[model samples]
Target: MLYWTLKYVLLGPLLKLFWPTKVTGLDNIPKTGGAIVASNHLAVVDSFFLPTHVKRRIVFLAKSEYFTEPGIKGKFKKWFFSGTGQYPVDRSGGSAGQAALDTGVRLLREGRLLGVYPEGTRSPDGRLHKGKTGIARMALQARVPVIPVAMVGTDKVNPIGSKMWWPRRIEIHIGAPLDFSRYDGLAGDRFVERSIADEVMYNLMELSGQEYVDIYAARAKELADAEHAGTRVAVPMQEHARDATRTPETEAS
Candidate 1:
């Protein structure tokens, strides 16, 4: 398959040599069968880099926008996504979540790995956000193990505004697979769903060590945007300081 070919032959080896990342608790991943990998989303690299480090292929429900672009770039994006075990989901949960859940269940039923970020988007301040119940729904539907993964320091290597890759030490900490068979028969009730989602978030918090923000991706995005705006506000002050340092009166001359 192109995925493996590109990974083992190109990306994986290159990452090993150049990226030189470290992985911990990788054995927590199930070597066989269908399971869920519940992880914290940091940077865009989280998706590609996670897959490269894993032994088996992991399928993720990526945003539909990634597949809907123009020209050769779009074509390549679509091809790579499809070939690398990713499927498109609308992300708004308007019929899209169900469609993805359906596909996810199918993958699990067939004994494959399903990768999902319960936070739904990259953490705004690199802190874990309140997880949506989609991950819980998937586990309840599939009746499979959910592995907790925490990827640290990746945000710095490929932050939101960075145009190029900068080397940053990375660590992938995979926790043991969580067993949720205790609530096997109760999957539909809202209260039960929230309870399960909370438990999932708790485990993720332990693995990630991020401050838990109780909100969805949209709200987190708003907060992150505000922080970025603050950075812009401080930039002028920093520039002023630099300018003053260069002034003749401030200089030794």
Candidate 2:
């Protein structure tokens, strides 16, 4: 298969030789059966390296743009992404979350390992951000365990806004599988779903040792962009008031 050949033969050897990755807790991943591999989004290379280190195949829900490029080079890009066990999903608008949940549930039901970043987007400042509840909903819908993974030093290898890849050491840490069977049959409850997602993020914070922020990474990026452009984006007073009282558990949603 192309996935195996790329990981073990083509890109894998070159990656190992240059980056020299260190992985721990490989046994935490289930050798058989369905599970969610929830990780913190640090860099674009996080996706490329995580799958290479894990023995089991990991299918990531990537942005649709990756597969929708134009021309012959675009065709090759689509082929490489698809052949590497990655699927495309549109990540725009409100419906995007639901679409991702549906895709993930289908993969889990098929007894496949689904790699997801609960933060929804990469950390703009390298700090772990609040997780969206889609991950919890997927686990509940599929009745699968959640495995928290941490990728350290990936941001250095390929940081945001950087085109060149640095030959820095990377570390992949796999934590113990987290069971959410206690909330079985309660996936529809928003409160319970948020709690499940918060628990997963808490584990990731511990494994990755990154500062945990109880705000969505996308929103943070928006505010950051506005600041950088010297444009004032008004924050509603009520929203600020609510943020003052926001708890970590409730923010995970």
Candidate 3:
């Protein structure tokens, strides 16, 4: 398959030759069956490096725009993504988001490993952000264990808005799987979903040792962009409630 050829024959060897990636916790990955690999998104290459290091093929739902562009380059992009075992999903929220979640659940039900970025978007400042509940919903609905993965130094390799990829030392830490079977069939409950997502984020925070922001990465990026543009955006106080209630040990560094 193209995935194996790319990983073993082509790109993977070149990446390992230059990048010097350190991966821990290979034993944590399930050899068979379905599960979720929940990771912190840092740079665009996060997707590439994460899967390259893992033995099991991971499926990610990439944004549909990547598959819809018109041109020879776009056609190649679609082929490459497909060959890499990634499919496109509409990122538009509401029904679209639900559809994507359903697709993830279906993949899990089919005994496939699913890669999810709980933060929804890459961190603008390299700090872990609050996880979206969609990840929780998918895990609970699929009855699959969630493995928290921390990708270190990927941002330095392919930095935000950077065209060149540097061969930085990338570290991947895989934590033990978190089980939410006790809350099975409760994925529809918003409170339960939020708690599950928070638990996943907490594990990621501990593993990655990154400063944890209680706000979603997308929202944080928006506020940051607004400030840079000289436009003040008011952050709702309710969003900070989770931060206020956290213990001192779990406080953002």
Candidate 4:
């Protein structure tokens, strides 16, 4: 298959030689069955490095734009992403977001490994951001476990706005699977979904050792861009520094 070919024969060896990945706790990943691999988004290379290190094929829900671009380069990107086990989903909110969630749940139910960035977008400042509830909802809907993964040093290899990647040591830490069976049959409850999302984020914060920001990554990016553009926007103080020790169980209680 194309996925195996790329990971083993073509791109994987090249990436390993350059980056020299160090992986730990890889056995935490289930050898079989469906699970959601939730991770913190740092840089674009996080996607490439994580899949190559893992033995199983990880199907990620990529933004639709990657597959919809026009012309020759676009065609190659579409083919590459598709051949490497990525499926395009619209990131726009409302119906499009729901559609993506449905697609993820369907994949999980079909016993496939689904890689998800719970933060929804890459962090603008390398701090872990608050997670979207879509991942929690999908886990609940599919009755699957959620595995927390942390990719360290990927930001250095491919920083934001960089067109080329540099050789850097990469560390991948895979954490134990999280079970949400206690909240079974509560897929549509917004409060439950948020709690689950928070729990996953908490694990990622612990694993990656990155400062946790309670704001969504997309919003943080917008505020950062505005400030960079000389707009006087009141920046909201992040509460995570003070509340960093709080866990989801404590919040739920």
How many clashing residue pairs, candidate 3?
0
Worst 10 residues of 3 by lDDT: 244-253
Question: Which model is ahead, 3 or 4, in terms of TM-score?
Answer: 3
**What CA RMSD would you report for each candidate?**
11.9, 5.5, 5.9, 6.7
By how many angstroms RMSD does model 3 differ from the true structure?
Answer: 5.9
The backbone clash count of each candidate, in order, is 0, 0, 0, 0
- All candidates' TM-scores? 0.82, 0.89, 0.91, 0.88
Lowest summed lDDT window (length 10), candidate 2: 243-252
Per-residue alpha-carbon lDDT of candidate 2 for residues 103-179, written as tens digits (9 for 90 to 100) = 78988999999998888778899999888888888899999999999999988998788877899999999999999
| Candidate 3 TM-score versus the reference | 0.91
Q: How many pairs of residues in model 4 come into backbone collision?
A: 0
lDDT score, candidate 4, position 252: 7
Candidate 3 lDDT score relative to the true structure = 0.82
Question: Taking the tens digit of each residue's C-alpha lDDT, what string does model 3 give over 1-253?
Answer: 9889988888888888989998999899999999999988888787788889999998888667777889998998787887676867765654556667878889999999988888877889899998888888888888999999999998899888887888789999999999999998897898998899999999999999999988888788999999999999998886743211110010011
TM-score of decoy 4? 0.88
Ranking by TM-score: 3, 2, 4, 1
Distance (Å) between predicted and true CA of 41, model 3?
A: 0.8
Task: Flag clash pairs in model 1.
Answer: none
